[model samples]
Target: MSDAQELAALLAQLPDAELAGVVGAATEGRAGLAALHAVARSLADTLGHAPDVIDVTPDTLPVAGYSQSETVGGSGQVGAGPVAPGIPVPPAGIPTAPSIGGYSSAGVPTFESVRDKVEQRYGTSQGMGELDRQTPVGRSVEEQWEARAEAARERLDQIRKSMQGNDSE
Candidate 1:
């Protein structure tokens, strides 16, 4: 068989998740940085700039000597250390937040009206994918299990009380 076909056969043996992991690793490695640098250099050349003015945020890049697994599993340690404050500044032309539309004579614009206006401008009514401020975070598995057990105990206590009352009568 041809080399390309042989490589494809080998790759096909891997499951989708494993293949995706391989791809993610490749894109987050030196190869990825080199690719990004190339793109930035190309953009600079095209724009007639001697040096690229594009600045990638430090948080976006992987820290030195940290593996992908270590980075992914470090969520618990996230707010444990002192955090440096960073207020993001929007670009000159772009607004910091989407304009939810103006208050008409009827006061606040209706959802339909705001959606219509947003759809007209962006071709879709999907605003910034921010979570609703009022939506509470879900309970952990242990919390949920404890709650269920509590409810079950209360139900059993009620049944026992009713049985005792019937026996006395």
Candidate 2:
């Protein structure tokens, strides 16, 4: 028998749970292989030649640290200072601004101020005014519940009459 036929025969002997586990593992393996293949194809397309072998080691791997490329002073060299850990280095060409709880010296509106301005300009929040108008004015929760209950009772009476007529026929 061929390898596929032999594998299928072996799989048939396995319990339902074991077979499902094998199938799941095989699916995950296939997906991982497919992803690796796609990455290789993308690299080949981008670069003139694709690498035959990628030798990844601890030394070759990127370490997380603040990049010294951003010079503190007008001097073209980076200053020797201890950077706070876990702080990320911003990418090149992007303007960096200091912010305090969304408030900035760059004339950017803070979160609270923005919300207030929007409320003032639009006359309450987007749909709050419409919601208020739609709501029954001066009606208590108990009154609304009683009104809904009366409507339900009327509907139930109609259904009962229809059912009684059907039974008589």
Candidate 3:
């Protein structure tokens, strides 16, 4: 007998009070399990009357002329009809994106090619040669720092003159 049937037989021999006591004791630490057991018992009682045999065949087969694939195993021989069951072919007239990666209708766009396309469609960035032609020669870092220091000194002189006038007042 199955473990469930054996358990049921053992439980049946217990007195009503003893069974109640056993259930009460189990409920303390195994409340979730007890609740699950109760639900399973209720479902078993409801569904025990009859078990139905279900039909599990497909409603319709693929049309006779429909061949799943043009080539089978690279043998160049076309399949006569629908091969082993698979996803149905999408209806025609639905627009689909082009395949990506190696050996497809459209070649995969490379970074350089994509960049060139974008530059051509949009405009190219300022080339170093063009920048050199347009801009004056750049000062060295030390010369740039000296220019900033001179500007700061002139600003400080102006501030000092303004403060002197305020102090006199």
- Which one is best on lDDT? 2
- Per-model TM against the reference: 0.19, 0.20, 0.20
The RMSD (Cα, Å) of candidate 3 is 25.3
C-alpha lDDT score of every prediction, in listed order? 0.51, 0.56, 0.53
User: Best to worst by lDDT, what's the order?
Assistant: 2, 3, 1
The true-versus-predicted C-alpha distance at residue 155 of model 2, in Å, is 2.6
- Across 1-169, the per-residue lDDT of candidate 1 in tens digits comes to 7645765676688655444443333334356476765554554455455332223224434458854444322255644444442343433432223333454433456777887787786743233222322235323554777899999999999999999999999
In model 3, which range of ten residues has the least summed lDDT?
49-58
RMSD per candidate (Å) reads 22.5, 23.5, 25.3
For candidate 1, what is the total of clashing residue pairs? 0
Of 1 and 2, the candidate ahead on TM-score is 2
Off by over 4 Å in 3: 31-169
**How well is each residue in 65-157 modelled by candidate 2, as lDDT tens digits?**
844444244443466443323334433433346664355655466888788778787886646766755667624555788899999999999
On lDDT, the stronger of 1 and 3 is 3
